[model samples]
Target: MTTAPIRLGTRRSALAMAQSSQVARALERVSGRSVELVQIVSEGDASRASLSQLGGTGVFATRLRDALRADECDLLVHSLKDLPTADAPGLLLAATPERADARDVVLTRDGTALADLAPGATVGTGSPRRIAQVRGENPGVEVRDLRGNVDSRMRRVRDGELDAIVLAAAGLSRLGAEIDLVAEPRDLAAWPAAAGQGSLAVETRADADAELLETLRALDDPRTRFAVIVERAILAGVEAGCHAPVGVHAVIDDDELRVRAAVYGAQPGDEVVVDRAEPLAQEYIRPQGSGKGADAASRVAHERASGIGALVAGLLLDRGAAELISPSTAS
Candidate 1:
């Protein structure tokens, strides 16, 4: 008997298409089921206004999720960072595939690194975190709010419309754009990434097809899942949005997962609160049998990650992170 093709919802942007195509191929490979792309135009993609004005966080994922709920598509793919921490009713964040490089890259016309950029240089980026970090690092450089697709942003650097632009290394890699100066993940003390920056979220309706759900579970990556879990937990704990001048990066060190968080106030030149969580065990469940306990390990990782995240957040708040970001934050 033949089965109907699974519909994977995606945005029409080049980056979105590239990522969604990857998910489609993975699903077909694991499930042996045909897949089709259903383009869903997101409000974020349609609007020319700032992301905050258009409603921060989840703007890109909202319409696709609406499509999934309306049965217009079977599932949707999203950049995990674009997903808001708030739970979506009737939707399950089913899986997070393996992550890519989670670093910020500075693209310049002269192939200059962030450290070498000239004083008063005009840098392009709409991210508050990047703005604050740039100012913190080099108080002279000017960061302008930039908005556009990957190619459009890159054009500014090449055409000399701007001296430089900061972008996600994972996005540049996925788009296959040539970038010379990347702030590596190893330099997290100076440039932590946005929570879930390099991860992909596979979301489906809560009442999704059982076979499809099984296929999604097969695509889950425990390490990636847990790493983003830690990162996102920190974000949620701080009550921050994608546009918030907050950065969180989580990584596995030996047998433990370590989460680093950075929060900046509204002013680009203001001080930042940088703190980390105690390294927690990578897996809560002991490995046994042929390693089929991956799901159980992920659950344990989530729990531990959450606990560590809450602890770290409380520490930062005590250190004045809340007041730094929002002057009106209750004491």
Candidate 2:
């Protein structure tokens, strides 16, 4: 009997292909199953305007999720940062691989960091998060939205459309597209990064085959998973996305969680704010043991992380670090 192959859904972009292939390879090892890639052209890929015009956050992930729901694929893979804050009722984030470099890398013609860029030099990026931070750092510099896959964006710089571009360091490393990156951007005060930016998310439907689901779960990295939740919670709290400038970085070291977050206006030159936090020593905080020890611990940890994130975001907003958000969060 021929075993059914595990179908993995992915976007057509080079980064998406690389990420999807990595997950397929991992799943094959875990379940001894043949895996196949299903490329779903996303709306974001088809749209020519800015991502903000392409529809808000998750534009890149919705198509894959829909395919997963229709049973077209055994599982769907996504860049964790591109996923929206809300979860699909019938789908679950079965796993998140260990995180990669969470920093936003600055690629320039010269071997110079952000600080070394010439005065009034133009920086390129499609992310509002990067735009705000770049503008905030050097008001004298010009910032513009530069979209397309990594190579496409790099092409613009080579064609003299831009002097440098801000890209995820993890992406360049994954695609081996690093010759353009003049330097790696760092400093929470200056450039934090999108929440969950360097992680990958594996989604499986609620009714997916049991053995397959468990096999996929094996790819989950608990440390990275929790770290992303913490980071994403901050993004959700501030309601940051394609149109909003929000940066979040969370790390797990020695079983302790540390998060640094930043929020800025439409242009960083306008205003900016940043903050950091660390979860309490206790694994999770629960009030009077609401349930079984373990269950309560998980609940407590999630709530604590959420609360910490909210506190940091609120503090930043109140300080005029991030601009006023719409009445609704999905803005």
Candidate 3:
């Protein structure tokens, strides 16, 4: 009987295809088998009219995931940030490769720093997190809702559709559309990134397509993997990090992990309390599951990350960040 080839379901966005290529190359290296990318038109792409009008976070991820469950594709690739915190039935986040720069970059025409962007200058971004932070920094600046791949977004600034736009450095770098940075790219303290920015997730069926799963794991890098786990855990506590304009930045330091995230309320734009946590930095994270059981490293990281997140949240609340909470989920 002929064998079915490994089909990798991915979104049609430039960055999504770009990230999927890495997975394809790795699978080839390990399995010595050809890997094919299946472009899945995700809901996010179809509903490009505006993200704010869409129901919520899952639009970008659900469709590709559906393809995997339907056996139309053997696996899928996703931006860790775009994935919903709520787990999918019969699906697994099998592997997360090394992370990228989990920070936001402020791009502008004059090449001025974020703080230097001319007052009242309009900044383009669809992210609540970036918009809140940007407005907090410059109350007079305008925050516009922008959606599209790196090229489309960048062209806005080039063609003067916008004066400046804020975007994830990782997205730009992966799409090979790097541009002049109006502000330095840094972590949570400097500029908190949308929860899962700069990270990638590889999803497979619950049964773990034996050969495919093993081959993909070879691409997993310990440092970035652990960092994202902690980042995602912190995100979980916040309920789909996107809802609150939440952003997280994490790193491995001295065998100890220092994590930080922000929670902003629905104010016109204000400083949300940014919090920090330190989970022990074990070199790598491997789940110890016995036939559907939870992972050992994930359990440890999840509990520790949330506890620290709560502490950080409390700390920030006390520091005049109580005003950032939203009255109801802003659509």
Best by TM-score: 1
Task: Name the candidate that leads on lDDT.
Answer: 1
**Which portions of model 2 show Cα errors greater than 4 Å?**
178-181, 267-274, 280-301, 317-323, 326-330
True-vs-predicted CA distance for residue 11, candidate 1, Å: 0.9
TM-score of every model versus the real structure: 0.91, 0.87, 0.86
lDDT of 3: 0.71
lDDT of candidate 3 over 1-331, digit per residue (tens): 2245678899887788999998888877767778889999977898776665675567788888878889888889888887777679999888788888777877877776667677778889887777778877777788888987787887888888788888887887788875753545644676778766788888899896566656666766656666666666655654443545777777777656676766665554545545454646452454333333435655565565556555655565566554554533322
Ranking under TM-score, best-scoring first?
1, 2, 3
Given candidate 3, what's the lDDT at residue 201?
Answer: 87
Clashing pairs in model 1? none
Judged by lDDT relative to the true structure, which candidate is superior, 1 or 2?
Answer: 1
Residue-level lDDT of model 2, residues 36-111, one tens digit each, is 9999988988887887667668889888888988888878988888888876789988778888887877777666
The TM-score of candidate 1 is: 0.91
Q: Which stretches of candidate 1 lie over 4 Å from their true place?
A: 178-186, 277-279, 282-298, 327-331
The lDDT, on a scale of 0 to 1, for candidate 2 is 0.74
Cα-based lDDT at residue 300, candidate 1? 67
Task: In model 1, state the lDDT of residue 180.
Answer: 43
Poorest 10 consecutive residues by lDDT, candidate 2:
282-291
> RMSD for each model, in Å, please?
3.1, 4.0, 3.4
Q: Give the Cα-based TM-score of candidate 3 against the true structure.
A: 0.86
